[model samples]
Target: ELKVEQNPLFLSMQEGKNYTIYCNYSTTSDRLYWYRQDPGKSLESLFVLLSNGAVKQEGRLMASLDTKARLSTLHITAAVHDLSATYFCAVDINNTDKLIFGTGTRLQVFP
Candidate 1:
């Protein structure tokens, strides 16, 4: 099986709302990362989780990694039209740079 899974392949959220996306992995990994991509643009780094219980946040987005459970979460707060984008989580197996990415979560922030 592939290494990663993300829930809610698509999400439509209203402005001023909150949501959380979950990412689950099948194997042990050394690092987990979250990225966001605007329409027609490359992904921009959101968070990099290096160890168990590592958590990071920026603006309205927060990400956490639990190595022991092989899980990661990206929480979105106060949705806005500007936040409409696709989110992806990736895992670096055994500390290698080659990351296996989740299918992705497409979020639409309704105005």
Candidate 2:
């Protein structure tokens, strides 16, 4: 079966604090994508990991993939209130033009 899972579904982070979000998959895949969303807003693409050890970063967020272990991670550095949002990781299983997303991680950054 193909599945994706994210731990710590809800997160409350303090300003200047750092944290990492973990994502695990149950099947082989060719690509993975990371995205961010604000309340009532559409998702914004953050990273795309296409191969083993692939990584992408933007600002305070970094995302990586390890295809061998079917794992991916998103790390946040020095979080800020402005970074409060929900993050999602999706996997393109079967390379069939479809993406199955893991349960989202909602983060609240406070001062």
Least well predicted 10-residue stretch by lDDT in candidate 1:
1-10
- For all predicted structures, in order, the TM-scores are 0.95, 0.96
The positional error of residue 16 in candidate 1, measured at the CA in angstroms, is 0.8
Global lDDT scores for all candidate models = 0.92, 0.92
In candidate 2, which residue pairs get closer than 3 Å at backbone N, Cα or C atoms, i.e. clash? none
Look at candidate 1 and tell me the lDDT of residue 67: 87
TM-score of 1: 0.95
Going through the candidates in the order shown, the clash numbers are 0, 0
| Global lDDT of model 2 | 0.92
What is candidate 2's lDDT per residue for 1-111, written digit by digit as tens?
788999779999899999999999999986999989999999999998999999888899999999999999999999989888999999998788799999999999988
Q: Write the per-residue lDDT of candidate 1 for residues 1-111, one digit (tens) a residue.
A: 557999989999999999999999999985999999998999999899999999998999999998888999999899889988999999998776889999999999898
